[model samples]
Target chain A: DTAVSQTPKYLVTQMGNDKSIKCEQNLGHDTMYWYKQDSKKFLKIMFSYNNKELIINETVPNRFSPKSPDKAHLNLHINSLELGDSAVYFCASSLSGNQETQYFGPGTRLLVL
Target chain B: QQQVKQSPQSLIVQKGGISIINCAYENTAFDYFPWYQQFPGKGPALLIAIRPDVSEKKEGRFTISFNKSAKQFSLHIMDSQPGDSATYFCAANYLGGKLIFGQGTELSVKP
Candidate 1:
């Protein structure tokens, strides 16, 4: 069984458009995170949410927003996307914050054209 | 500055050989270090981890060597196999929650 899952394996949108990526985890974890992997394969954390409450917010742009409806679901919404947003977005979850092992989804590859 | 720096952006190893990847962190407060492996089109999965209190931790064919004072860690894969080809990332957990990941290393095991 897949512990973590993400929708839209690939996304291609024009600039200034809006899109959303959904993630779900069945591991019964309380902390969820959004990460971005660039062309150089540099992985960086975008946001972290614990028990549906925002915890760590990186220096990401305001157009990128994360919404966690519950502990099992966390969605990312990007508004007015730009070419710079073209990268792979990964969704991860852990038991709670604090360096626990994180289970990651298959990831959503977003390409802003 | 890159908090966690990984060396060898890519690597090629022969089957049955050993593969090594190194990482260093700037934050001395980090206590938990983890290694993640990602195959093609897959998300990163936890492979092995170590704490500052221990110098080494071995799990099956994977081993992690940590140097707390130097803020450095390394992952060693023994008996490399074609199925083990993947990208490896080393990450340090600062103060518990936030994880700082190193630049990934793509390892290809040749059969």
Candidate 2:
């Protein structure tokens, strides 16, 4: 079974359009995270939620928001996407905030034209 | 600033050769170190990890050598094969804190 899964594995949209990516984890973990990997393959953490409560929020723009409906689901919503927003987004989960061994899902590649 | 620094942005090794990738961190609080392997169009998967208390940990053909005093660690792949061609990342985690990853190394093992 897939431990962590993300919807819309590939997303291509025009600039200024809005879109959302859904992530689900079946590992029974309490901590979930959203990360963005740029063209240079540098991964940076965007947000983190533990038990459906937002705990960490990076310096991401307000246009990018992460919503966790429950402990098993976390979704990212992007409004007015720009060219610079084109990158790979990854969703990860761990047993707890201190559990650093995160299991990552197949990344969603988003391209803004 | 990048908390973890990795060497050799890319590497090419012959089959059966040994491939080494190094990483360094300045954060003394980081106690857990892990190496992740990633392929094209796929997410990174944890391969092996080590703690600061140990100087070395070996798993099959992969080994992690750590230097706590230097705050540096490295991953070594023995008898590298074509199937091992992928991007490898080194990450550091503070005990109860988030993980900070290195820039990653693209390793290509030629057959």
Model 1's number of clashes is: 1
Which pairs of residues collide in candidate 2? none
Task: Judge candidate 2 against the unseen true structure and give its global Cα lDDT, from 0 to 1.
Answer: 0.93
lDDT of 1 by residue, A1-113 (tens): 98999999999999999999999999889999999999988888999889999988999999999999998999999999999999999999988644457788999999988
Would you give the TM-score of chain B in model 2?
0.96
| Candidate 1 C-alpha lDDT tens digits along B20-91 | 999988877776899999998889999998888999999999999998888788999999999999999999
Off by over 4 Å in 1: A97-99
Cα distance off (Å), candidate 1, residue A80: 0.2
Best by lDDT: 2
Q: Give all candidates' CA lDDT scores.
A: 0.91, 0.93
- After TM-score superposition, what is the CA distance of residue A82 in candidate 2 from its true location, in Å? 0.9
- Please state the CAPRI-style docking class of candidate 1: medium
Evaluated on CA atoms against the true complex, candidate 2 attains a DockQ of 0.72
Candidate 2 docking classification: medium
- Put down candidate 2 lDDT per residue, B1-72, tens digits, no spaces: 339999889999999999999999998888799999999999999999999999999999999999999889
